[model samples]
Target: MGNIIQLSKSSPTSEWIDMSNQGTDCFLELLIMAANDLEKTNHQEKLISFLKDQKDINDIAPGTAGFKLDEMPWCDETLIDDASFLICVTKEAQSESVLSKLPYKVNTEIVFPWLKQFAVLIELMITASER
Candidate 1:
């Protein structure tokens, strides 16, 4: 198994405060980099393929499934562009249903795919999270 690195050390509270500030700065920088890349390559087919592969890994299909989030989780790390959109599968068919509320311009609907074997739906969830 891989080892995990703890971000905090058992140190003085002042040191921890400094570390927290540094960590937040680092996170913001990473988020900015990710946003730049997302915008630069938003229309690239490769990125779409990458997203599709991730969706498959998460067992996300084109139609409704058990994994659709009732409340859409916003992805704070990603910045959406014109091509940036959300993909989800839902069987619910009410006006107030989760799927129906998604913005029409950026959301796509399809049947959910069955997973071969895995409890991890992080791929799709992360994609949704990114949106």
Candidate 2:
């Protein structure tokens, strides 16, 4: 995961002054950094670049264990079941055909773990926002 998602903001380039990440809002912090990176790169940067500003991931992220994105709007049955989101993402990452559609190179080793961690946060927000 050290290729892109592992590039720590603190240890990397000292030339570009990184904005403070000490804010209490974890979600807001991500949005702010995304906006900052977008502006600096003329809005042409890959998602991986934004990932570099995050803390290095040294271990595997936990799989789906709570609220599911594929099951939103509980009254209606319109989404995939629990864990299917993770399965689809992993499938796409592993597919050579899907890889061609991406703007950046796909390193399955780096991506799968990132997806797991990302999926959890998404589920958390969905659960919170829906409440």
Candidate 3:
């Protein structure tokens, strides 16, 4: 069993996101929920689109993720290093200082759990920003 990540707005209602394939959408949703709108810049938009593309392809063929982590035409992010099942890449997103770089891999199995924690990070950043 995987861990549970809970989230809710200003209501009595709540949602529990399981930290696994079932919560893939939650990760993608969290990317969208990020406070800075990456879509505003054409380059940033491409990065966002690339993220969706990689995730979709990953859901279909998990092994193909390694090849997809190459140089992006729209952004300066690049693969800094890699191993048999992992790829480390440059981080270019605007974020809270807790992180100096973006997650350096394309595997959903890895990303989902990391994203669960990232969701909390984003929520805290957003909540703090609004205050």
- The clash count of every prediction, one per candidate, is 9, 0, 0
TM-score of 2: 0.28
Instruction: List, residue by residue over 1-131, the lDDT tens digit for candidate 1.
Output: 11111112332233211212222222222222233333344343343344334334334332221122212233345524312332211112111343233344211221112110111232434444456
List TM-scores for all candidates, in order. 0.19, 0.28, 0.33
Model 1 vs. true fold: TM: 0.19
Q: Per-model C-alpha lDDT, please?
A: 0.27, 0.33, 0.38
Better of 2 and 3 by lDDT: 3
List residue ranges in candidate 3 displaced over 4 A: 1-26, 33-39, 66-70, 74-131
Error of 2 at 100 (Å): 3.7
Candidate 2 accuracy as lDDT: 0.33
Residue 50 miss distance in model 1 (angstroms)? 27
Judged by lDDT, which candidate is best? 3
Residue pairs in candidate 3 whose N, alpha carbon or C atoms collide under 3 angstroms: none
Q: Which RMSD does model 2 reach against the true structure? A: 15.0
lDDT of 2 by residue, 5-117 (tens): 11123323422222222211222233323333223321223222333333222112221112222232222232223223333443444445545554556455544454445
The count of residue-pair clashes in candidate 1 stands at 9
